[model samples]
Target: MPELTLEATSAIAVAFAAVMTVGFAARQQRWGPGLMVVGILGFLGIISFGIVTRL
Candidate 1:
């Protein structure tokens, strides 16, 4: 897969949050799953930022 640009990383984070919100509304899932997903995405974003700054 291609590497994600900063914009793509952030956009996906937002999109996942939105999807999770909708899922919550329907009582289809709990907070744990969404939290984990966003957590990992946020971590990646943070790591990328650090790498970019160091470059």
Candidate 2:
């Protein structure tokens, strides 16, 4: 099993925030649900990464 470093966790959080920001912008612009899907996938990916890193 592996442990996640603080830097890695911070980076992931930053990436998640960026994705959410983009999702919000897209929604405001009426860009359809594609960006929303991407945002959801991004979130899931972050969670998966955390789990994998912890193992």
Candidate 3:
């Protein structure tokens, strides 16, 4: 197995977060899910930023 770099890991995390955000946004009937999506994106952003800074 090959070792994955920080960029690859960050890309996967962002993709997963984007999918969840879309799924939650599609419901359009609850504020909780929407807020969850925002939180997920925010967390991903912070993580990516940290990863980039370390590089």
Candidate whose lDDT is highest: 2
lDDT of 1 by residue, 1-55 (tens): 3466789867877866675566556555566567556656766766686677677
The pairs that clash in candidate 2 are none
Q: Pick the candidate with the highest TM-score.
A: 2
> What TM-score does each of the candidates earn?
0.45, 0.53, 0.46
Q: Per-residue lDDT tens digits of candidate 3, residues 1-55?
A: 2445778867767776776677577657666577667757767776676677767
Which 10 consecutive residues of model 2 have the lowest summed lDDT?
Answer: 28-37
- The lDDT per prediction is 0.66, 0.72, 0.68
Q: Tell me the spans in candidate 2 whose CA falls farther than 4 Å from its real position.
A: 28-55
- Sorted on TM-score, highest at the top, how do the candidates line up? 2, 3, 1
Give a tens-digit lDDT track for model 2, residues 1-55. 5666879867876776776678777775666356667767877877787788766
Sequence-dependent TM-score of model 2: 0.53
What order do candidates take by lDDT, descending?
A: 2, 3, 1
Would you give me the overall lDDT of model 2? 0.72
Query: What's model 3's overall lDDT?
Result: 0.68
Model 1 clashing residue pairs (backbone) = none
